[model samples]
Target chain A: MKNLLTSRWFGLFIPLIAIGFGFFAGALIMLISGNNPVTGYVALVEGVFGDLYYFGETLQQMIPLIFSGIAVAFAFRTGLLNIGVEGQLIVGWFAAVIVGISIEAPLMIHLPLAILGGAIAGALWGFVPGLLKARLQVHEVIVTIMMNYIAMHVANALIRAYFQESGQRTAFIHDSASLASEFLAEITNFSRLHWGFFLAVLACVLMWFLLWKTKLGFELRSVGHNRQASAYAGMNVNTNIIMSMSISGGFAGVGGAMLGLGTFEYAEILSSFTDYGFDGIAVALLGASNAIGIFFSSFLFGGLQQGANNMQGQANVAPELADIIIALIIFFVASSYLIRWIYSRLQSKKEGK
Target chain B: MADILQILYTIVPAALIASTPLLLTALGGLFSERSGVVNIGLEGLMVMGAFSGIVGTLFFESIGFGFASPWMGMLAAIILGAVFSLFHAVASITLKADQIVSGVALNFLALGLSVFIVREVFDRGQTDAISARLFRIDVPFLSEIPVIGPMFFSRIYATTFLAFIVVAIVWYVIFKTPFGLRLRSVGEHPMAADTMGIKVTRMRYIGVMLSGALGGLGGAIFAITTAGNFSAGTIVGQGFMALAALIFGKWHPVGAMGAAVFFGFAQALSISAQQIPGLAEIPQVYMLILPYVLTILALAGFVGKAEPPKALNQTD
Candidate 1:
């Protein structure tokens, strides 16, 4: 009976309860705000799957989330808390946009070139903190936090300087570098669906293979478990740390590339940060810092956001309610000790503690 | 040299005003960390405080509180911030949840809940601009002194003085009192403290609650003084800056105050750079990002080493 508590299946049950509590708490919030939770929830469902267009929009949103989730999950697996994914993602977007606009080339070359540009830019951003953490013994958290503001200011300045010749945003990417798909858009009732979805899914598989089936991944996990132990075992912990951060940053960079080459197709001045990177933290946590888990969790969060837009438009509920719901979900998960204790009591009543 | 001196004199008031919130929040962080509980949710607490500060002020003014509305609003923020911090405290202390994760959740909750409530109340995503702000005071006898007096003391916000006093009180409490000693002991070695009959959990809770109250007060000061309104962008990264200040100061109340003032001065330099002779030639981006860059440098052992409590983030 005690074995049941530690079973892998029980692990799954905790997240489920956390999710259930999140919705329940969200409903309670709605009730207090003088809104009908039933109507709000129904609206939320409709917003996500009521039609192909909503579904496409949800998928579109999920693409970047998936990449960012991978980025965050990768770093987490290496025992690194990357709060700077947002900053890395921004620079990635900027790099991709710059590559897309400059240097004409074949579609095959231009698109890959732009994507690689973004990936490299993001890697550089992540590498700095990783390097600091490795060499100077500075905490990555503080460096990354500092890095976020620097990225924001630097990105904005670059955009403004780039468009000094009279334009609100950068010119739309060249066709060769574009990710928009007319066929998919039409099938989804003119939604902003793009080919980035395939890449996001592909990245998940790649991450899974790399982490579970590769030597480097093992070393990274080892370092994460205990740096001193890994070093004693002859592992190059410093190299592993730097490598994990760069790869994680590559994933985030690709996510940003989707925004540039897929969604907006032009670079605008980023006065404030987009929520995708920050949301990456939540998705990584809710997903248990695994590829498959991140895939599903990001999808869930993306749906919540889409449904939130619908709830706001249809039921007059604030869209920020989705954020509240996500926050509550994280809270429940964080307080899993309480849930586990209650579970123990219930089980004890049935048979044993 | 004369231009440097002039720049310093001109920027003092603005620097002090800006430092008030950071000083208050960092001191709160010191208390919480000293009790062995890492409070990363300080940012979120500040956000909620900022939101409540604005909303409470508006509500009080609507009820004809006149000049007293902002103060009452500050009271509301303090209460709300402390209550909101209970979520973090429970998860970190009693529930033994991951402190950083709980802190992250608290941040999201604060921002989401605050914006959601604002939208519901004002039919917008932000609050109405506050009307009755606490105006600056020219110190009575102190302002009459010469250049030093006018530069350092005149036209300062009352909260600036209050923050310094709070720092002194916190220092005394942490270094000079029995309760303070127990709290530090609990943070450093909970097992030993437990054997000593100290209520480790209770001390942690009190420490966290104190953080929430002071953090809330800091957020309120930020909104009431500089912003004059509350919005999503109003408190951006200031809480993180406060956290950095706490670390930069090596977890000491007076040290935190000094570090916060340094950050504040950097921020003031950003805004006042055009008036400073040679500094005007520097790019705006450089000025804007100076504080963050300096924080990175400080943490990299450029400033000094900062050691946290021994038992911080230990769930067991």
Candidate 2:
């Protein structure tokens, strides 16, 4: 009984239970709203898997979520919460668009350069708060929150000044700079699914390798686990903090680049936040802050997002109902102690039997 | 000189109006933080408060409580705000969840639940504008004063005055009362407080509830005075700005009020920038970004060391 309780699998079990509870609560909410929970859930499932186009849309949604999830999970492993992923993502999208327009080259050079530019911009944005926290002991949460607004306004101004194509959005990037793959599109019935999906998968693998195999990753995790002990053991805490944040920001930057280059092929001015960064927090928590876990969690969240429109249309459930369910999932996951307590009681009952 | 006075006339009253919500919310944050429980969900709480306030007012007006509907709305907001905040308190205090994550979760829940209810009830994303907005009134004796009267007393919201009064009350409660001492002790050193027979959990709960009450009132004021209706964007980033004010003010009620006023001045300037000579040349986006930049700089210890409550995010 004790072994089962202490096993590594228990960590995975708690989140599953939390998700189960979340869905149950969602069902209750639906019932109270005078809707059939079964019908709504079925409609949601069909929306994600009804046709090739729906599947493509789901995959497309998963791409940025995967990137953002990895970004958040990496930061968590390094003992940081990168709430400014939204800011980094916005800056990255802008940088990718800037590079896409300014540099006239073949796809071989232009696309990679645009993507790299985005990563670099996001890295720079992440570096500022990381540097401040490491050097001056300033709290990262408030700084990151402030940075999100600053990034939004700056991005808006930049789009208005340099990239305005008539309305709030910029002109589409040249073909060479685009990540839109015709082959993938044709297979998916012309959905927005693009090469960025491959990039997202690659990022997850890279995250795993970097965190588990690399010496720097070891140092970063040590610093995150015990800053005082790590510092005493000769790890450069400041450097690792900056490195973790920069890399985390780079991941979100890639997500933003995927949005601009693959999905929309242009940067649009936003009056409010895109919310992917905030959603990344929930994903990282549910995924348990691991590469494989984040990938799966992102897929789930992505499916929920894609399925929400269908649920609203077919079942008369508000799209925001999905958000409420996601929030409840997070709430349940946050209260892991409750899950642990419940598991212990069940285990004791089985032992007595 | 005349132009400067003219700008002041336009900016000062606007600044006071803007500062009211920030001051109220910051005071709410002050209470929660003082009890060692950080409430980043102030934003979410404000949203709930604003939504409930408008909805309550609309309902009361429909039922024929014409002149008293706004007060009833504020009352509803306070009750709902406190109830909603209990989720954060339970998650953070009882469940021993990471306070920041729980707070963030509360934010998502508040926004989602409020929007969902709005759609379910109104069949739209927003409610109709409430007709029972809180009106501004001039103070009897104070309005007769010279230039200062118009600037500070004339045509100001009663809620603004209420916010200032609450600031004083909070200051007195936090610094001068035995209950305040116990609350501070639990926040700073829960184990020590426990050893001394102070109920740490109870103190923290009260502190969190106090924040909820003030936050709800702040949201109601924002809805009644500024938004006049409940919408997703009504609360906007005012709750966050109030948080900044909490930090900038060094966690003291009077200090937070001062900080809120400073931010309010910045916000007011942003709104009226195009009307001001020479300020018209600069882009409005820069003005919008200024307060956030200032907040970041303040937090970075450029202005001064903004020390937070000890053991603020620690789990018992």
Candidate 3:
């Protein structure tokens, strides 16, 4: 019974059940608010999958989420919680936009350079907290939270000073630096579905391979699992910590580049957090901090966010319901031990019968 | 020199008003962290309190309890805050979930739920301004004191006095009481506390609830004083600032209060920077980012390593 409950497939079942409960709680909230749950859900489903345009929108939403989720999952595997993904992502977005606008090169060189600029900026952002934690044992949670605000302000100030074009946002990037694809746009009925979607998928695959197939991945995971033990086993814990955070930040940086070079092709002044970073934390948690799991969960979150507009317009359900449901889902996932206990108890009962 | 004093007079009152909320919320954080459960959801809890406080005030006023509305609003905030915090308590203590994740989830839930309710009930993105706000009060004899009176007592919100009184009570409860010992022990060494018949889970639960109540009061005070209405941006990052103050104070009630005042002074400076002589040259964005940068420096142990509760973030 224990073995069966501990099986790999059973791990997926816990999140599935949590998702179900989350939906149930959301439906109850709707009912209490005097809205019809069935109509609301139908609108939600149709919003994400009704037509090619809707499906494309959902895919567009999924791109950044997938990158951020992978970023967070990667850091978690190294036993570090990268709450600073938001800061890294914002810095990355600014770096990509700056590079995209400044340099005028051929498409082949310019696109990659812009993306790499973002990745490097994000890596630097992640490196600060990583260095602090490694040397001083300073907690990353508060530091990252602080860095997020600083990053937002810094990004805003830089855009206002250098990149502003008489609007709240910067000038559009050069066409050669953009990730938008004409063919993909035509196929999706002119939705903003771009080449970044393909990049997101590639990132997931890369994360899986890097974590499971490489010696450094093993060292990173070992350090995450047991820092003292890893140190005794001759691993340079500080270097690995910095490397893990840098790599994780790189993923988020690319995710941020998707926003700059794909969806918007410009950077806007942000008065508050973009919320993608926070959403990434939820996605990583729901995905159990695994690459493939992150991909699927990102799609789920993307669908809900995409559908929320329709739900609010047609069913008279507030768009905030999606946020509430997502929060509940994370809450349930955090309580997975209870789910495991219930699953094991039911398994034992079935065997006894 | 006279101009400087005039600026200080305006800034000091603003600082007192600002610090009141932080002082209340940081005290709440101290309680939860002392019991070994890191409640990063203080921001969310504060949001809930602010929303509900306004709602309660409006509801009571509509029913013709105009004079009693604000106090009633505070009471409702405390009840709702305690209820909302149960999710954190269950997730962290009973289910043994990751405390940070649970706290973050609570923040999301609070923001989403409050916004949803506001749209439904008020048909707007934010709640209507409450008619009966907690007004500034003048102390009888204290207000007559020459320099000290105007800066400290006159034209201050009752919540500011309430905050100081709460701090003294919190200090007494946390230091001089038997319950405080058990709560501290549970945080430091839960296994040892458990073996000593102290009931670590129960102590932790009580600590979290106390935090919720105080956090709720802080939110109520913020709503009544600064915001005047509940909007999505009303609690913008203050809860986080309070968390920073909690760390800056090194997790003590009096220390937390002192840190809260320091943060409040920073906030006050940012608001009135143009009036100040030297700070007028810097961009507002730089001033806005100052508190957050200071928070990071504080956490980096520039003031000294702020030791957290030993069993903090550890699952049972």
Candidate 4:
């Protein structure tokens, strides 16, 4: 037990400790602002866990984080930086929405079609940077960033032209038939939880399977560790780069569809994006890019999001404080090396004891 | 003749303002990139700066106060940006974390922090527009010249001039001075520079901080000139465009300036496309997406063989 506690698992322990610190810090800030920290935290805890409705909302938020987290994690495993997941998500969302509304189909067909549409759109979006990195030798970072603008403008234009009705968002998907219903929602009231949550979990499982089980996964991981050696081993380095981005994008796209078809249901013209794609980056990092880790981390993040409003409403604190806390959490988590060093030193002394 | 001149006349002024933010940030990125660290946190720095600039101007509306206030805002933004960038520096430099992941984390942290602060302070998502916006200043004697005079010399913001001066100063600092040479050397080969007694980590920190300062300046100018208010879109993708410009410019100050001006012209063309007789039929979105699409193409083709600093991906 001592050995296990002192091992690299301590890396995971630090973030949990950081969360405790973040909460304490947040409470102090609340106190300074003349709000009761305990009340705020109690409200937060109650809002997220008190009722089924809030629980569903938390799950709804987790859907996007799961897929986007996988997207970032996939890229991380491949030794590439896919900052353009925002752009990819936008494009994929548009594609899925366009198909969701444009085609008329039975429930079984329509749902699969919309999800597929999103996946294809996202994959294509990812392919651009992947191809650029592979063929042209341009950095994925630059390509992804540039692609983000193109995706944004393109998505915005499409919304204005086709998806919107007289400048408002398009009509709701075909009422009950077009929506994704979850057993959990039925068990409770009409909560935000839907079938998309399962899909998100399924995606996490599939991601893990692909990363660890298959030959493609092995090749991809090997290439990520060292491209030159992977090439010497006869792995197609360029192909893997493009494939990784495409798969990453597809995951993010599916996440986007969950928002449009499952949760939000109606695609409104946003001046900016929903930011789930960006948040996914933090989720992926915090989860340590593991399937089970992503699941738990995403839930934690979703809880924070769900509880933020509670803190706002009950404690008279701004809802945005949740975002600040999330940011701080990610900041501390990203610098885990410092925390780990401290952990190791303390562990070494204990081992001596 | 009159119609063509009209097109030219319209594009020049539009391009000048459009180029200002890109010019400043690209110069900022140049420092970081040439020193061998890719500063993807440019976007976050720009956003923070934009928020503070508008806040400063909104709280103090007089001309002198606005001028001084924006600088104070710039100061606040720089501190925030520098602190935020330390996240990247620590991850990428000290901890040997992937620079790209670190950059993405910075992007999120900045976005979340900015939105949180804005919502908390303003009770709404965005700041109120500055009452007294950045004013146009015409050159004393040069404003009188026909066509070119007003287009080039007149009707430009003071920030535009500052961008130009910054470019020149950056160029001088990077190439002419010993400090710049050392910085450049560190970016290309940290191990070699380290062997030569240059503190590689410190230099990287300086590069990141310098980029943060300039990015903040760019973001401030963007808010003051274009939006006259701080909103989520204030800095937007301009930071990425600045990143593109850094690569397109081959990591040189003058090259970045030219690339920024080119980008400015593309951006201005899209806006003025509606005014052009033949182009009026094209959708406004087409014009809006013009700069971005053109940047991808330029990166693919026009930016040929422009190599990044050798040690760009090197950590230890």
Candidate 5:
């Protein structure tokens, strides 16, 4: 039991150590720029948890990240590199926002329908890479990246032609039919956290079940572990590969919808989809592609993202330094051996006693 | 007859200038991949070098004829670019992290860091335009030839000729030299190379550093020739195009040069395609996106997996 605890705890330590190293390096950078690192850090901490509103904003910022993280994490389990999550999320967000605005239905149907529309749209985007990978043996990395540009241009062009406003955003959704009611907003101070947090959690649970408990999960894992052996064992390698990406894309798309409908309400034309897709990759790595790990990692990432503004406002540091920290975390997680070495050394010391 | 001469003159130089960066970076990737490292961070390194070169030249301007400053700036760009790539090397080579993920992280880091520093330190979203740009050099005696002379000798930047020279040097170093054989051995079979006294780690380090140098040179050329300034989006997807060129060239030096020229021709035509008589009616956006679309087609197996170096995808 003790060994298991130590072993299990080390998984979490990797991200923690990465965070430490990133901060240490950031401090060095701050010193070079002639700023006090301590004050910068304090500002960051306070910015995320300074007040009730700040805390709520943190949760709001975390909503899409959590969902996208789960999406990427789910694909990671199946050995699929779903780099197109960004594209899928944008398509999903477009569908969700369009449905949210166009519908006049009651709250329940409108909300669920919007979410479903977004998920289905994202799944379709995901399906292209899956099909190419499965049928033509194309690398998903290249296809997903190309899909990102395609999704961006297509979305931008459609928004301009069909949905342009004085600003680059769509018309606001009807108040009565919004995902969150005014009464709820009054209580929560209009935080974007609405019910999407629960949806993200539910998606995580769903992914866990789909990856572990089902016969399909077994086939997918087998294929991921060794495709040739799985093929020899008569499993449908191509189908499972496509299906994994499809489901992964579906989850990411819904994550996008959660962002647009639950928080921003209007689909604004962005130069690029907020880096949710890329952030999702980082989140999945930090989570070790496990459901609970994903949950905690999402919060850590979400908090850092939420705190970036505070870091900027007070510390005289650029908000982008937060990205540097995030990159460092992902870098360390990828090189997890550094953490393992520390863990083994620590464990031996504890055992020697 | 005048119009025919004008068309040929315009087309040839445009092809050479447009392909210069592609040729340099593709050759860079050839060096890295042939020695067993899948370097997808070429784009990020290029951006870093672009920014560094612009800044270097900006500060060093007022030197004679804009010559010493830009050359020094190019050197500075190469050094900074190589230093930037250490992040990738450490993460992938030392940490045994997933190379693709590390590469992606480098891209993000480069984008955010460059933008942030430029915004905060420079008080603007981008660097100042460089004053000292590379000058077009004409070969003294060679400019007299009737057809090919003007195309090759006149109105060419010094770096374009340097790129051609580098290609020859890279090809020689890879195929005809002892160091090249050892590097190739490490990439082909690290375990065997390790037993035979070739240092796998050191070889890979050299490969990555060389990639950084070439990527920087490619980026510096971009700043001098086309952009003439370091700004956001100055190098949008040029690095990825170089990656596509490398793969299309089947991971060979001369082949990559050919592929780079081909891509460059396509890119040049895409821009000029809108200017031509029959093609003017087409949308400009489509022209801008043609290279990316073509890259997807290429990646989709216009060139099959003619097997990358055996150790290229493997980690030590």
Candidate 6:
């Protein structure tokens, strides 16, 4: 039992079962709604795998999910709950667009700069909450919630003030700042695949490498495990908290850049949230907060996002069904204590047998 | 002088009306937090309440209970909201999941489920605006006061008065009653409370359920009085704002009420500022962000370190 508790495969196994339960619940929902669960699921699968175009769209969705998932997971690693990822992503999106619009440089210089610009903006957005939590012992949850609103309104205002185009969005980003690749696009049959895919995969690798292969990561995880113990052990808990938050925000910001430079090519004013940052929470939880786990979980979230649209189109299912499935997955994953308990019961039963 | 008086009348009543929902929801938060559970699912509960409130009203009206439909709807919302909150309770309290994660899941579930039901029933995104909505009533004796009457006492929804009454009742119950003491003790130190023979788990459950009821009432009041309908967007960040109020008020009932009113006043000023001479010059974004910024500042110890109950978020 103890060995199973410590096994890494056990971690992966739990999430797989949670995902299975999520699909099972989704099927029940489909049946209850007078829609055939099989048809609904079939439509969901075909939506993502049917064509190169749909596959490309799923990748486009997955890129942001990956970055945002990292944003949430990185913070979770350092004993911080970054509910402000949406806000950070918003600021990063705008900052990236601002850089893309203003900077006239070579592709080598401009694209990375725009992406960096986004990271900085997101970091700044996250810094305030991190500072408050570190300094005043204020709950980060409330501060992050407030920050999300501040980001939305401030970003909208900035968009309207300086970058108001004829329509709702900013002017198209410069060609040099674009993440689009003609090669990827042509291969995907004119789908919105771009260089953001590479960046997202790199982000996953970066997170894995930074956390598993560094001393700072060790210190951060130590703090997460026990802040008092870490402080007694000569770790600067406050600094670690702030650093984790800023890095998390930077990851989320890159997600914003993916949308601004790769998918949309312009920044639009938002009344509602982008949903990527929020969904990242679901992804992070579903992934068990591991880099590889985040990669796969993001694929699930991303596939659902694109597939649900097709389900709505072809099978007449609401795309919100995707959200419902994700929510159920989180719930199932969250209640793994029950799973563990059930496992224990089964173990006892086998012994009795 | 007359212009100032007129402005006060419009803004103060508007502020009170707006504060009603926050006041009710924050009180609910107060119960849950004071009992050691951080009800981040306040937002989701309100969404469930909002959906049910409108649906209940429509059902009541269809059954020929025309004038009483809104009240019935409010009752229905409270019941449904409390039941919906069981998901959170089971996840956090029973299953011992991460409270924050569970809450976030509930928020997503609420929105998704509500919209799914809407699509199923109306074949559209929003329900029809119910005819029998709650109305503002003039306090016959109080409205006749020279200056303060029109601003504070006149033309308010009955729900607003009920909310204030609820605040007083909650204050009394929390500060005076043995049950409230047990709940607070459980939140403060579950082991200690358990040692003292207090049913910590039971108190926490009651606390969470009460929050759900109040949160549901808040949602129903907003829908039946202000929104007059329900939809996907019905309860957008109000739950979080109410949570802020609960924190800013430092887990005290009256304090939370004051914080809620303060928040509402800021909101009212922002909305009514376009008519005010000097304030109209401020950017809309600044106006919109004002309440949130103030909440952040208050939480940053500017309000002198609003300490939460010690065992908040711990599932004992």
DockQ of each: 0.77, 0.82, 0.82, 0.52, 0.56, 0.80
> Residue A268's C-alpha lDDT in candidate 3?
93
lDDT of 1 by residue, A1-353 (tens): 57767998777787889999999999999999999999999999999999899999999999999999999889988899888899999999989999999869999999999999989999999999999889877777778878888988888877787643346577788999999999989999999989999999999999999888999989988888899999999999889988998998889999999999999898777767887888998898888888888889989999999999999989999999999999999988878888999998888897843
| Per-residue alpha-carbon lDDT of candidate 2 for residues A1-353, written as tens digits (9 for 90 to 100) | 47766889988998899889988998998899888999999999998998798889999998988888888888888899888999999999989988887779999999999999999988888999899989998888888889988999999998988789968999888999999999999999999999999999999999999999999989989998999999999999999999999999999998899998999999999988888988999889999998888888988888998998899889888888888888889989999988888878998898899
Docking class of 6: medium
Off by more than 4 A, model 3? A351-353
TM-score of chain A, all candidates: 0.97, 0.98, 0.97, 0.93, 0.92, 0.98
Model 2 in CAPRI terms: which quality?
high
Q: Give a tens-digit lDDT track for model 4, residues B1-316.
A: 8888877777887898898889888888888778788777788878877776677666665446745676566666666666666777877788776666667667766666677667667777788777676688888988899887878888888789888999899999999998898999999888889999998888888888888878877888888778877766667678888887777787888988888898888788777787888888888777666666666666676646667898886665
Model 5, residue A198: C-alpha shift (Å)? 3.4
| Model 1 complex DockQ against the native | 0.77
Model 1 chain A: worst 10 consecutive residues (lDDT sum): A161-170
Which window of ten consecutive residues has the lowest lDDT sum in model 5 chain B? B283-292
Candidate 5 per-residue lDDT over residues A138-175, each given as its tens digit: 77876787777677767776777788775898877655
What is the Å distance of residue A196 in model 4 from its true position?
Answer: 1.1
Model 5 residue runs over 4 Å out of place are A1-6, A97-111, A160-195, A266-273, A342-353, B1-15, B62-66, B135-156, B302-306
How much TM-score does chain B earn in each model?
A: 0.96, 0.97, 0.97, 0.92, 0.92, 0.98
Worst 10 residues of 3 chain A by lDDT: A1-10
Q: Give the per-residue lDDT digits (tens) of candidate 6, residues A1-353.
A: 64675688779878888999999998999889899888899999999999899999999899999999999999999889999999999999999999999999999999999999999999988888888888878878889989999999899999999898968889999999999999999999899999999999999999988888999989888988999999999999999988888989999998999999999999998967887888999999889899888989999999998999899878888888998989999998999998888887887897799
Q: Candidate 1 on B1-316: residue-level lDDT in tens?
A: 6666666667998898889999999988888999998888889989988988888999999999988999998899999888989998998999998888888888899999999988998898778898999988888888888777878787788889999999999999999999999999998999999999999999999999889999998999899888988888888888988988898888899889888998899889888888877789887788677778877877777877677788988887
Interface root-mean-square deviation, each candidate: 1.2, 0.9, 0.9, 2.3, 1.9, 1.0
- Tens digits of per-residue lDDT for model 4, A187-222: 656687888888999999999999999999998889
Pull out the clashing pairs in model 2: none
Query: Where is the poorest 10-residue window by lDDT in model 4 chain B?
Result: B58-67
Off by over 4 Å in 1: A163-168, B1-6
Error of 5 at B235 (Å): 3.6
